[model samples]
Target: MRLNSLYSELQWLPRAPEDFAARLKAAIGSSETDVGRALQRLANYALDLNRLSKLASAIDKAKSGGRSLQPLQPFRLAVLSNSTIDMIVPAMVATAARHGIALEVIQPSYDQVAQEALAPDSRVNSSQPDAVLFALDYRALPLKLSPGDAEAASATVEGGIAYLQTLRDNIKSNTHALCVFQNFVPPAEALFGSLDRAVKGTLRSLIGEINRRLADFVTESGDVLLDVNALAETVGLAEWHDTQLWNLAKFPFAVEFIPLYADHVARTLAAVRGKSRKVLILDLDNTIWGGIIGDDGLEGIQIAQGDPVGEAHLSLQRFALELRQRGVVLAVSSKNDEGIAREPFQKHPEMLLKLDHIAVFQANWEDKATNIRAIAEELSLGLDAMVLVDDNPAERGLVRELLPQVAVPELPDDPSWYARTLAAAGYFEAVTIAQEDLKRAGYYQDNARRASLRSSAGGVEAYLASLEMTITFQPFDATGRSRIVQLINKSNQYNLTTRRYTEPQVIAAETDPEVFTLQVRLADTFGDSGMISAIICRLSQPGEWEIDTWLMSCRVLGRRVEHMVLREILEHARANGIRRLTGTYLPTERNALVKDHYAKLGFVKTGEDDSGASRWELRVEDAWPAAAPMKVVSHGFARPKETLSV
Candidate 1:
């Protein structure tokens, strides 16, 4: 965000240290097998191209030396564009380091978007990249100004999407790669003053129509869409486009904006790979409002309307509330008396954020680093899944040094820009939002109520019985496909194999005769937690079914949801004449929580691999005993005739 052209819209990653050159050298010379976190810490700084280029060089050296970037998942990306894409690849590779992705790029020849996608033997297809980015601009697209003919303008718009659709379809069919298409950025040159927006046949109108339609295409196809038009508009259209540079070097935009562009693209990649942050930890005192409630008292604080200083803080509250509504869990990390912190949220009439919006609230004199870790533990989330926003530089620096995994964005001095700066950070970039997602914060809050009930109940059986939980089981269907794919990628800590599946692959499993899929939802007396668990089992042999994926939301971890899920699995297996169920536990940095998952469910260990992946098997002859106390509702597949007795 420090770059003058793209300020106020991207993350204010920390500035480089005075000894950054030496640090970069040391990182490159590191003998450790994996230098991912070390390099990621460096890339999380506010770096210009010169520094980014040096980091890129160091990354290349590390790769050449046969080192690993373990924490960063390896991603093979193919970029198809009409402009000078070669110059942009290095920055992308370097910036992707910050997003926990080790990017392996395959760049076909410049302006080969059509040829590379269509040709069977093309390098783009042969690369078999995980994703294909169609980085086309307006000029590269089929758009023309008819100057007054609406039908001609409509034809141009229709033709533009058809062109992109053909390329997208061909690339996907050939490589099975998820298509990432960027909408066109129209030039600053408007044909008529202000009329360009309303009049058909104008270049502005034609480009707008295409971009709008293109967005719908990506949504329907379950692919990714990068709104370059919105990014350019935020940066100022005049500053975003460099006509002279395009004529000189065939550059799509100014070279200076490459770092910002790369950051956006890398974030999209991270979101697709399920690395997006989930929690927003906010500081209360001068951060959310004009004054501290602990000292200023309730009436002394400035948070109401008609006041300039007060409205600024209100803006941040409004923004945080909006993020919470979209599944970004909210937490409060404050150094104040607990009662004082609660007073503002409870008593302040103008506060947009109530106590209900927050999933965790840490109010104490302890250091923020400790409180942040506590919040993570309570939420059952990772430190890397959080972003801490504080008004005080000291608190920010303390968190940056102590909890390096927690993203500490640089805050501007002006309180008015707090919301805008956080908005620009894009730490919670999402490709899709589900109904379950919208109520995620409420789910965590409901978990707290369950905890309270458990504390007073004094026994596990009593607590379980008091909650009155019910779980519904249904086969994978079109209505639940989006949430299903999301939970598959996002539920890392509870996943057994940690395998990723694209939309098309999940669709294939829906009606596959040999495949079995289950989508489970849980509801208690307190509230309904949407789609808390999912399982996929594949036919391994005539009488054996292998559990390809078994994952659950940790919100229901201690509630015996696992036992209930296994019960449902047994019912389906028995109905299908499956005698054995095979389960695999592939170890990862985050999934150790589930290392003993299968073992706890009475699975016998069968095999172990060098990477710590262990396989287990369960033999089923008849109905398996249900271990949990909750009632289950199952609508079994018609072929096997599965049923659950109340």
Candidate 2:
């Protein structure tokens, strides 16, 4: 969509009432489950910064008033900026609320980026934020446009990078926070017109160099990059840079773009928290083609290369295919006869997506919400991990009402904007793509076949043996660092501790003598399931080890992967001369599946609080065989010779 239409085309249902602020005020002092639907209904709208600020203010009141906001992840963020960001914090909180995060931003006094990041006792470090956002631009760094001085230009870029890197290193060392860097956005006032990009010493060229180098730095550090430069360019540099506002109060960009900027930042934080959407549920008919396939037979549907309407649908198909290739699970939830839905994929020439691309196909006449839930069940994922894109506003509205957790972005009357709208929504945000990620769609497809195999195998034991699964248990190493961190953050339902660890923290575990870590993988007759589990244990005393982190991807839930993983843990504990193993189940709205996790594995329950969180202890000497069908592949604690990069 055009920059002019950034806030225009989303017609998502259950729009905020005219008295939205009043409703938010009333929502305070109420339980989240009781007020959750109302909160989501209000948050569903494409609200401006002013409205968002009001909503955020109410949420803050509820938090301070001791009302519970369960199911919402709380994130403390330290914002180290060179400009005025006080006006932007509320919008950030509100947008993060839309993504199911209660964001608390810590902003120091104006232009204190250097001192706050460096001083150990600074306000930012005292809060111990999960993330530190370095919101610096060209003016915040040392950049001088010396004409005919290419050597000086190079020094300027290196110096700026060094300055930022020092801040990131200090913050990380002080508080163990992941750094988020914002690349500088060049001003629209180019002195040399198009040559600004070509000249080495020009401000535009300097910024170009900085942005490129910034990406490399972020990749190497395993931190995050907020490409404000790209955001500004997307909105047109003219619209992004407000000269008057900057001169007045040092606003980083135009106030109009604050809402969009906040939304992007929130989604990034959600991705880091493993809350980003995984599945894209698509509606057929005018959505993918010109007419209903049932009415217009396979030959009559208007999906062609030449026609404008057909081309629009084709664009969306291509985009979905690209997403699937990059690890997004694509599902079809159309209200059509299964045979009719299959007809186009089997026979249509211009169709870009085939049946093979879909991980789940629910073409029944059931309500869209029901079918969407069915899709989630079939894939072993949560409703929160899905985004429903439907052309019908009524369907979108109903889905929003019944399933507030699912993301439903409305499509306009025209079909062309469908891809743009969905792309701009940023539902399926990811920070890193692993080898397993590229094959996620294929893994779901394989899961369907495995489910079919289970039904005919007669008994659970027979089914487990027929697959011939192999469990690979290895300590965390360089090769699997990225995927291990991903599992630690994302796998909520099967996660025992529901702990989140940054890449640096994961790396730290590798060399720490007091800690032991494991990365688990499984492969069966069907396919390699990749690294599905990660565990970390810290030495609690002279003879005991406490489970600091334990999580598994839910995709392998019923296959007895956890049994095999526990077996490895017991073996390692025994080899290390450990006397006992302690495990705790910290309860959350999403982790009830694992409340009795330790109990299921034969540990004696020691205690539980009112909230049902429990602790368990297992004597390593009393451990027996885990007895799963999977063949074991033991790496035997092959620790890395050197620290691995993430």
In terms of lDDT, the best-performing candidate is 1
Model 2, 1-646: lDDT tens digits are 4645554322332346788777776766355675544554566677877788888887787778676565667899999988899889998888788888878899999999989988999999988998998888678988888655789999988988899889988898799888888889999998878888788889988889888998999988799998788778777889888989999999998888887888878888988888889998889988878799999888788899999999999999999999999999999999999998988988898999999999999998999999999999888899999998888888988998799889998777888888887887888888887889998989999989989988888998889888888888788898899999888888878887788888888999988999999898888999999999899999999779999999988878887777777777887788789999999999876788888788888899999899788899999899874578767777747532222111
Question: What is the TM-score of candidate 2?
Answer: 0.96
lDDT by residue (1-646, candidate 1, tens digit) is 3444335234477778878889998877665754878898899987777787888888877877778877877888999999997768988888999898888889998899999999878999988998999999888887878968999999999999999999988898788688899998889988897999999989889988898999999999899999888888888888889999999989999877888888889999989888899999999988898888888999988898999989999999999999998989999999999988998899888988898888999999999999999999999998999999899999999999999889988987878888888888789999887899898888888888888888899899878888888888899998889899888878889999988876777888997999999999999899999898889999998999999999999999888899888888887788788999999999998899999999888899999999999999998863365667787787756744333333
lDDT of 2 at 339: 92
lDDT computed for candidate 2: 0.84
Q: Stretches of candidate 1 above 4 Å error?
A: 1-11, 31-34, 639-646
Worst 10 residues of 2 by lDDT: 637-646
Every model's TM-score: 0.96, 0.96
> Clash pairs of candidate 2?
none
